[model samples]
Structure formats: C-alpha cells, structure tokens
Target: MSNELSVDNLVTGYGKQEIVHDISVSARPGQITCIFGPNGSGKSTVVKAIAGLLPAWSGRITLGNTELTGLPVHAMVRNGIVMMPQGGGVFPRFTVMENLRMGGYALDNKQVVEDRIEALIADYPNLQRRRNTAAGSLSGGEQMMVAIARALVTDPEFVMLDEPSAGLSPALVHETMERVVSLKERGVGVIMVEQNIREALPVADSVYIFAGGKRKFAGTQKDIRDDNHLMSIYMGGD
Candidate 1:
C-alpha cells in the first residue's frame, strides 16, 4: 500500500464565500508536509476540508487508494485519518486517562483500546505520571501531548495538526515539535498548519505557502530559506 495522502484541485469555503482555490498538496508516510501562510489565507480551511469537517466544493482527496472526499469526521477516523485542532483537543473535564480512552471510542475491542492506551502511556512518561489529572489542569505543552497521544490510540495513518505551537513556551514548543518529528519516525504521514515557520520548517520535508486564498509557493525548506524574495513576502517585509 502506498501510504500517501493526496489533495487534488480542492475548492471549499463557508456559506457562499469561497476560500481555497485549486489547492493540491500531498503528504507521504514518514515525512512532514507543512501548510503555512498569512492570516485569512485559507490554510486552516484546506485542513478542515481534508479532515471532512468542512465539505469540499470541488476536489479529490485520497489516501492511497481510498477516496476521502465527502466522508464525515467519524468515517474519516475509521479510515485512519485523524485531525487535532488548534488550542487543545482534550476534554477539559475528563482525566488524562479518560480522555485517551475517549479517543479510541470507535474501536469495538476493549482490550485493544486498553492496550493502545498502555502503549501510549509507556511511550509518554508524562502521561503515565499524570494519568489521574484532569486534562484542563495540565500545562499547554502537556495538554498538546495528551491530544496527540489520544490521536495515536487509534493508530492513524495520516495525522493532521493545526497551530500546535501557538501560545507555548519556547522550551515547550521545541518539545512539541520533537513529538511531531517522532510521528514521521513512526512512519505516519503528518500534515501541519503552522504559523511558527521557524520551528516548523526544520521538521518539514515539503511546504505549501498560501496567500489570498491561493498557493504562492510550494517547495522544500531550502527553497523557501534560500529565496530572499519569498522570505520577504513570508515575513511581511518590503
């Protein structure tokens, strides 16, 4: 199976207003693909469209041979596609362990769910240590960890994250980005929508830059870094 998530000629928006236009991007297993742009550039809209939270007006979204164009959120999860939204994804009132359990709610086998939770806890010692704490009580980085760990309980093939570094401390941002890199190491395709370009570029294998609801540049980290003009545009410089 070719573990590649491809988005072809996608167009979507809210109400009668269109935001994304003919956007095509792809993420391969064991690599990170980042989508970044100025505010109102439709980066998050594209993510939502691919995640099935927002319907696409026109496009084809495929993971390997599976078509994911119109699948609902639950159906997308069952197909090994999980999206963790910005801020935090945990149930604030729930305990850390409970939140993790909720992530595997689609699974029928209780034992399998428990086993996955155990594996996640073992891999993330902080989760094991704070298993009893409410998700709302943890630090921003810890909460993000729980969110990502929760997504892993289902063993998703493609994981999409939005603005993970927002409001995190410098150290926490580094830790969070490291965890994102670990996802690639585990052979899962990662699609990230980030405004933290400095932190995100190092981990990205490919990048797509959007402006005014259109893609302005699509290339590697080196391509973006070496181009002074692109950097000027990206940094809002004259």
Candidate 2:
C-alpha cells in the first residue's frame, strides 16, 4: 500500500459558513508538508477536515487507495492518520502515561498499547521521569512533548499537527519545530499547520500557502524560496 495522504479539492466549514474552498494537498511518508498562512486564512480548517473532525463539503481524502473522507476520528487513527490539535490537546487530569495510552485506544490489544507507551517514555526521558505526573502540571514544552509522544503511540504513518508553536515562547517554538521535523526523520509524513513562516520554511520539504481560504501556492521548498514576489507579499521581504 502506498504511504501517501491526499486531499483533493476539499471544501468544508462549521455549520453553513464555508472557510476552505477547493483546496487540495498531499503528503508522503518521511516528508514535512507545511500548510502555512496568516491567522484566519483557514489553515486549521483544512487540517480539521483532513483529520475527520469536520466533514468535507465536497472532496475526497484518501490514504493511498483507502477512502478516508467521512471516517470518524477513531477510524482515521486505525487508518494510520493521527492529529494533534492546537494547544497540545492533552487531558490535563490524566497522568503522562495515561495520555499516551489514550492515543492507542482504537487498538484491540492492551499489551501492544503498553509496549508502545513504554518505548515512547524510554525515548523521551522527560516523559519517563514524569510518567505518573499529571500532564497539566508539566511545562509547555514538556506538554508538547507528551502530545507528540501520544500521537506516536499509534505508530501513525501520517501525523497532522495544528499550530504546534502557538502560545509557546521563542525557545519553546524552536524546540517544538525541531520535534516536528524529527517525525519526518522517523519516516512519518508530517502535515503541520503553521502561521510562523520563518520557522516552518526551514523544515518544510513541500509547502502550501493559503490566503483567504484559497491555496496561493503549492510547491517544493526551493520553489517557494525562488519566488521573490510571493516572499515580499507573505514573508515581508524586499
């Protein structure tokens, strides 16, 4: 099976108000696909639709050959697609270990879930040290770590992060982006919705720029770099 997630001409929004209009993008395993734009450009809406949180008004979302347009969130997890919403989306009252285990709730085997949690905690020493501590008690950066680790417990082929840098300090933003890039190194395709153009540009293998609910550009990193006009308009260039 192909390890690619494709969204073709997706149009979705809350209630009857359309926020995204005919936008399409794709991501491959081991690549970082950054969906970038300023606030209110509908970046998060697209991510939500792809993650099955919002139903597409008109489009097809597929994982390789498998149709995923209308599947529930849990169904998407089983399809190897996991989404980490903005603000880390951790269960504050749950312990760090418990949060990670929740990521694997769709799996039928408890042993598999426990084993994955153990491996993730071992890999992230901070999580290992605070395994029993409530996730809400950890620092912002640490909570982001928990969220990423929890998303990984499912061993997803595609991980979609909604503004992983939001509300983080400059240092923590850098740290979070580093962790996002690491997912590509692990052969997991990463679709990150970000407003920080500078931070997302460096790590993005493929780029999609949205404005007013429309995709203005979709190309490789080098293509985006070479477009001086686009840079001036979006990146505050000369």
Candidate 3:
C-alpha cells in the first residue's frame, strides 16, 4: 500500500453547481502540501470533500490503495485522516480536556484515547496548564493550539487543515505555521488550505494553486517562487 494521500481528477460542488473542476493533488508522509487561491476559488470545497463533509461529484481520494472518497467523517478519523476545519472549530463551552476527548471519539478503546490525550498534553505544555479551562476563554492562538492538540489525539497519519492561519496577527500567524511545520516533523502528512501566501509558501513542500474552481498551478515552493507571473498574480494580487 502506498503511504501517500492522493486525489485524482476531483470534481465536486454544492447542489448541482460544480465549484472544483477536475482538480488533482497529493501529499506524502512527513511533507506539507498547501492549497492556495483567492476567495471563491474552491480551496475549502476541496478540503471539505476530502474530509467527507461534502460528496464528491466525481474523482477519487485515496490513501495508498484505500479509497477514501465516500467514507464518513468518523470513518475517515478511524483511517487516520483527521480534518481541522476553518477557524479552529472548537466547542467553546467544553473544557480543554473535554475537547481533546472529543477528537478521540472514533476510537473504540478508552485506554488508547486516554493515552493519546496524555501524550499530547505532555507534548503541549500550554494544554497541560489549561486542561480544565473552557475552550472559549482561551486566547485566539491558545484556541488554535487547543484545536491542533485535539486533532492530534487521534494520532492521524494525514491531517487536513482549512485556513489554519486565518484571523490571526502576523506574529501569531508565524507561530501557527510553526506548529503546522511541527506536524510534518512528527511524520504527519499535512494538507493545508491557506490564504496567507507569504506565510504558506515558506513552509509548503508542494503547492497547488486554484482559480475559478480550477487548478492553475502545482509544483514545489521554488517552482512558485521562480515564476514571476504567478508570484505577481497570487502574491501581489491576493
């Protein structure tokens, strides 16, 4: 079985209207694959489709040979494909530990859940300090950290993050991107949809650029950096 997560000829949309037009992308273990486009370019739609929140009109999503196209969200979690949706979607009323526990909801073994949560907290000292605090009470960056920690509880092989750097100060954006890089360092394949081209490019191992619901570019960071026209269009225009 291949370790890479591959999306081939993906075509998906809302209600009969196609937003993403035959887009294909892939991510390998321990690498960061970033999808970037302007607003209304169908970046998030691709993520939602891969995460099983939306149905694929056509195409295939696979982890190695395992087809992930129609799997339910919980089933995807079980397959080590966890998605942290846009804006760090955390249950505001829930305590930090409670939120982490929710990430392990798909796991059948209670001991495994507890062990993973404990290990995550150990790795994130901030989570240890705020374990009992309500998620909403935490700062924005802190909440992002909580969201990441919760996702990690599943011990996912590949994580899909939508707009991870959204709604943050420049400094916090850098910190958040660092956390994302750390995920790659831990051998987790990361598929990130981001708007901050400046920040996203630095960490991106590979990039896919979309416009009008269609992919316009796909290559390494250097490929993007070398293309003066693309840099002007996405970086200057975005």
Give the candidate number with the greatest TM-score.
3
For model 2, what is the error of residue 18's alpha carbon versus the real structure, in angstroms, after optimal superposition? Answer: 1.3
lDDT of each: 0.88, 0.89, 0.89
lDDT measured at residue 156 in model 3 versus the true structure, 0 to 100: 90
Q: Which sections of candidate 3 miss by over 4 Å?
A: 225-227, 231-238
Better of 1 and 3 by lDDT: 3
Total residue pair clashes for candidate 2: 0
Candidate 1 wrong stretches, greater than 4 Å: 225-227, 232-238
Tens-digit lDDT track of model 1 for 43-134: 99999998899998999999889899999988888888889889657899999999999889877887998999999889889889999999
Candidate 3 local lDDT, 43-79, one digit each (tens): 9999898889998889999988889998899998988
Model 1 weakest 10-residue run by lDDT: 229-238
Local lDDT at 173 for model 1: 89
Quality of model 3 by C-alpha lDDT: 0.89
